[model samples]
Target: MMESQQEPKVTIPPLIPLEYSNRMMLKTILECGDDQIGLFGKTVVVGGWVKSSKEVKREPVAAALKPPTAAEAFPPSPGRKELSCVEVVQSRIPFFKKIIRVFGVSSDSYPGVREKFEPVPKPPPPPPSKFFLQISDASSISSLMVVIDSAVVPVSAGHVLPTGTCILAQGVLEKSSSHGKQTIELKVEKILHIGTVEPDTYPLSRKRLPLDSLRDYPHIRPRTTTVASITRICDTLDFAAHTFLHNHGFLHVQVPIITTIDSEGFSEKFQVTTSKKWGLGSGSDADVRHETVKAEQHIEARDKSKLGTGVKPEVKEDFFGRQSYLSVSGRLHLESYACALGNVYSFGPRFRAEKTGSIKQVAEMWVVEVEIAFSQLEDSMKCAEDCFKFLCKWILDHCPHDMKFVTKRIDKTIVHRLEYMMSISYERISYREAVDILRKVTDKTFETKLRWGVPLTAEHLSYLADDHYKRPVIIYDYPKAVKPFYVRLNDDGKTVAAFDMVVPKMGTVITGSQSEERLDMLSARMKEFDLSRDQYEWYQDLRKHGTVKHSGFRLGFDLMVLLMTTGLTDVRDVVPFPRTHGKANN
Candidate 1:
């Protein structure tokens, strides 16, 4: 079920007594451990893939004449002679059972002082011939041994229960007194095999798989512990993002994925087109140029015609009648809703036609773009800080178990990093001040020289956040020439009111700025970019009517998850179905 995207159909027991009905309570391995003490004499069910299995032969013994003491039990007295007792030889088979406990001990005097239970015995375990299963339910894993007779589940000598076979078992919880120690374990009565895998053919067996190897089988990789744990954390991140916005009175607005405008003015976007039946497929640049020139000549000829008649000139119809592309950002469209709704946010897929395959870049990724009316650059920075902090705290409180896996295997300092980020306020620095700090640093050589007007690279960003600041740093008031034309120009006319939030390890998780609200300023800026005037008339109208100072920032939702997860360095590994240059796999 974890390997597939479809939700599993769950069956729950009706309200009834544990002993009265045949139905068994479905419990997770973690839940089973919590109720270990109280679950005695109760019938419950658990499902997981079998880790190991073995067959055991049972021998019959006659009625005991007297009871045996503790020392004379299974690990019989070292030097004691064997008892001569009659044995009724009958054929029977036994299964394995072992105990697992999930709990902690505490004292009332010191409320915070706590202790864990003693570790399970490491010496001799149950006989090797019994069935054993290391079961995982994507939350916690446990070792489950079948303690049933062969009569319950008939098996031949040649029959084998291979690893990675999914199964559901109905059992009663009980304490086990085996060769030397006592432990709690399940005693299975009936079992059903949901699916079986051939040990020789299964790609993901019990062996530890490398992260890169898992990428080759994305469809089934979620069934593995690492991927499954990451998927769970991603779900929490998605919920936390929306919850933070909703709490701040931000309305969730759905924006179009297909748009006619390149919102960021980057010109890097995926073109959307229907089946090319009208000479639209596979054309060279020269051919496209020739066709464009022909279309222009036809329009010019029609315009030159003296239309003394009342009928308007006929126009050719085509798909959309204009070049449209997948949206690079929803910030432009979001402004429309923001102006009417006060504050609005869009969370969905955004595409880019970039060919680079850097760890931080992906062709298709999700972004959380926000827009706020009647606000300025400062307000955008404050809102970004508040929303980001909320998400960090939410994950720490909600997904501790999954986080433990990340902290243990990936970056050991992830928890501390997040805690520090949540504990202190984000420091703000002007772009010029940031450059000055970099210039003063003589210790490390920067690939890109420190300069006032140049755009900051990842190296510069990491140094500012991780090496110098030792925390998230917000650098604002970037040079106007290097920033988007829509960013509000300062009174000095040299720098624009733009900001970027950079954190240690992950550079620039959020980027935004106050937008130009003056009609003349916006028009002049658009012209500087060489964009067609008619294409932006709608955007310009907002300023002509009643535009107020507005600002907002966009956060790469998957990139944020990568930062929170610590050692996960690549955005491709974090996002499901990664779309990269020359690669788009389902």
Candidate 2:
């Protein structure tokens, strides 16, 4: 056997910093200094939508711009008197101090300094010098004031830069201590671009609009403060989730969105079809199948009992040579990878043929599914809890301002809820105990009555998390009748090693279980669930081969955001262009 040669390792350079060679974000400029003092005299290019603009007609006061000073130079410049006003624009700070000469001062040394100072002539007041327009780049909750000079820039401030108008400009930043508020104001020397919006038709013309009304303009909903804050929170939460998963030695695997197997066979699936009949293409076999379908268009004479035979010519014409649907979950696919990779996860959109128009239910949603090899129900719960807690902490650390704004305007107890979840461990109980607690509840009446064999409703989940435990609670060992066949059968024989993590306001945020690894036990469960054994040949092959005990869970990413953000009540509000039952226009 020949020995393999070792390849040389390549060294990668560090990433180049992007402090705006082309353009800078408002966030970078806003946080550049101690109260923005660091931005004095530094020129930058910035772009954003105009939140507010006003034409300020004020008389030019050079004294306000320049401070008075009395100091004598041994040799005063001849243009010192003429350059007094010009120096104010050049230097922000005053350069002279009043020094009284007690000793006899020489005439040559005090040539410019005299007992009585010459009065500087007041210059004529200039025309409406500039208009102040406030703009924000959606990167931060705060806005920067742009001092637009009409003579310098051709764009009309009042008409061209309305509430929803967008613009890009390059200018020098000057310190503005207006009304004792120390802030940085961009002195607009050039206007790069202007995106004007008609004031009469603009929906966000007002300073504040009702949250419900903003839902109508889904395209521009992110322009609002509430939506922008929610967006930042959601983005950070996404990164936080990825960070937690990567840190825990879980390999992220991409699962197919278009799948043949219905991982969760219990739910209705959205059928994937094409423009052609039976989803057939223009191949020779497709042509024959098309002719056969046309010939059997009317089956009134055919025996109805023969319909049980699925060997119809049209079935072969179907896409993938079998019926396929959008994946409702990635559990089965993740498990296949988990068995090989030891631990794996998949994060992507999962579609459901959901007709329910509830605030929490949507046709399409993003899910984070994880599978841990050589693990059981407890391992799944532990991983879920750690990931959940890390997400909450990440949001709190990264988006403190947004969270505060949300708390003051949306939900006041958001911070408390997150802190409570992080400070305490999630309570764990079995399905039977959860049912018992629900049965003993006397304060509130639930719409769905408590039953041992039936699935828990939103009401039951809420009661357990909010009222019973007053925190997040994990309920495990669900009844076999309620859980899917993939879940492992517990020793009790009546329940499965399945679990659900219920959050305070979000209800069930995560649900997972130890997969049935034993071939005979899995086959028995499949038989009991009335699932087709032939269709899951590959799944069964795993159990027949090197299948070890493995477990995993699925978390609704949107619901987790709602729980972390606290104020958001609907999952649609957090998701951009939410595809609900009747609302997919945008």
Candidate 3:
């Protein structure tokens, strides 16, 4: 029998086309799944324009190949070459060419390569694996790990990857477990540059970038870990809110932003307009000016007439041919739907025009509004508590990484705070009881503030949440005079069945009450408040036909985020670009 010797099988990584490779280079090349052998420990060629460079003084090869000018520095010329100042400066360092070759391990060894690159270098240097791998999907979960090509090092926190840059990472893939799940990670051995480069326009970096600095770059903030974590948490919470309501048989309704009624009755709204200016005159500049002057004179004459004969100016001729404003809350509209749907909720942007300078005010903000028919104030309170607790639990379970990052970096006590709130029952007290408690306090500032009819301020609400309850607390039965006219009048006739949900850090994040179902009472209450009866015809119609017992609450979504994540002093921090009183930034 003759022994036969066989040659070893040779495998090669499939060559990616220039076009396909071009797209791969534009983004961070985390993994190369095929053709592992071609990249392992081989001197591959790559070429591209220098995106960045750093001087390698210790390399004898660089010292010997130094060029006098920038033009002579790269691909050294046989003779002297003229170079510009920028080129001269760029030549002294190693340029990260667009097309480069990485002579390193295969993608299979990426995990081990990443592990080997983890230890800090001598002199407390940055990680040798200059770039960090970031893999994410639309859901913001199930990220895969791959090494960032060593050539693409992040210089600063705000440094952004160029639009297009082909990168070849020769690394080994190793299996690892994170959050109790098995996953593959790439350990890069070498980075090869390819001959393609694009301009860097997106703002991002791998440093400890400040959130304040990224305010102007909302579109790109999601690339950063902090902002990415926020986005993920926000998404999870939003889903959880809807899920909680849907599971409870609450119908989701999309409320219109532009409306004819000022639901909040605060008269703060962003009026919608189609024309550049309100069309007050028929035609011509002179005619328009004459009409404007005539309108002013009419207003003066009307005021004089009011003083003499108590006459009011007719406002029907003004803009839009009617009085209208953007909705500040969707509860009123949803209330109508609630009557039909049993339980309904509206989630959308709500506009306001209050100019107070505080951490809690914004011209435009998201609101989670719920209206329940045949429910009392206590039912609304329970619903509010359940919704908040469900949201916290859902985010914590589904977005563990994001929640961990947020709690540790943004708010140290987030999880604990939520857990404590869920376990402890919220202390329920009437507004009169709260006033009595405040009056009993030794704090002299509250000595004269034991009034039964005044509305509670943030300070008072904080005292209840922080000092009296030490958890979220619900204060109900406020004086009717201080509450909205829709609130049901209590047995005392002076108070109403309204409640405010106050948390430890965020006071009064939600305000709600049961509606007065009696048509006569509601009408009289509206008249007492001097509100227009015609303005609320639709709202009154709900009571006229078959008004049932109902209750609802309005929650400031941004304020909730602020309470859950960062203890932001200004509500603007939570929103991408908040529209404040005097400023509107895109």
Q: What lDDT does the true structure give each of the candidates? A: 0.74, 0.80, 0.67
After superposition, which runs of candidate 3 have C-alpha atoms over 4 Å from their true positions?
1-206, 278-320, 443-450
Query: Residue 547's C-alpha lDDT in candidate 2?
Result: 85
- lDDT per residue, candidate 3, 1-586, as tens digits? 9979987665554434246343222112223334343344432222222222222222222224222342223344458676655455445323322212254435454443221212222232343334444334223323434444434543332222342233454455454323434244455455554334334453542356677777777665655666656666667777888899999999999998888877756556777654323446769989998877776776677678788776665445456667677888788889889888899999999988877787687888898999999999889999998887777677667766666667777777777877776667778888888889988877647423557788888888888889877888889999888887888998878989999988898888888999888999998998888889888999999998888999999888888777764545567667877777777756
Clash list (residue pairs), candidate 1? 99-184
lDDT of 1 by residue, 1-586 (tens): 4776787544432323336534333333234433455556657676665556655665444444454432333344468765322111111111111111112322344433223212233333222234544455454423455465555555432333676677677787666535423245567777754566777777786567887777677786766777777887888989999999998899999999988887767558887654232234248978877776776677667657736554454322336766678988888888888888899999999998988968888888899999999999999999999988888898899878778878987889889888888989888999999999999999999988777899999999899898998889999999988887788989988899999999888898999999999888888888878777787778888888878889999999989988765459888778888888877757
TM-score per candidate, chains pooled = 0.74, 0.79, 0.66
lDDT of 1: 0.74
Rank the candidate models, highest TM-score first.
Answer: 2, 1, 3
lDDT of 2 by residue, 166-232 (tens): 8888899887746535377899898888887889999999878977788788899898888888888
Of 2 and 3, the candidate ahead on lDDT is: 2
Worst 10 residues of 1 by lDDT: 88-97
Q: Considering lDDT, where higher is better, how would the candidates rank from best to worst?
A: 2, 1, 3
lDDT of model 1 at position 3: 71
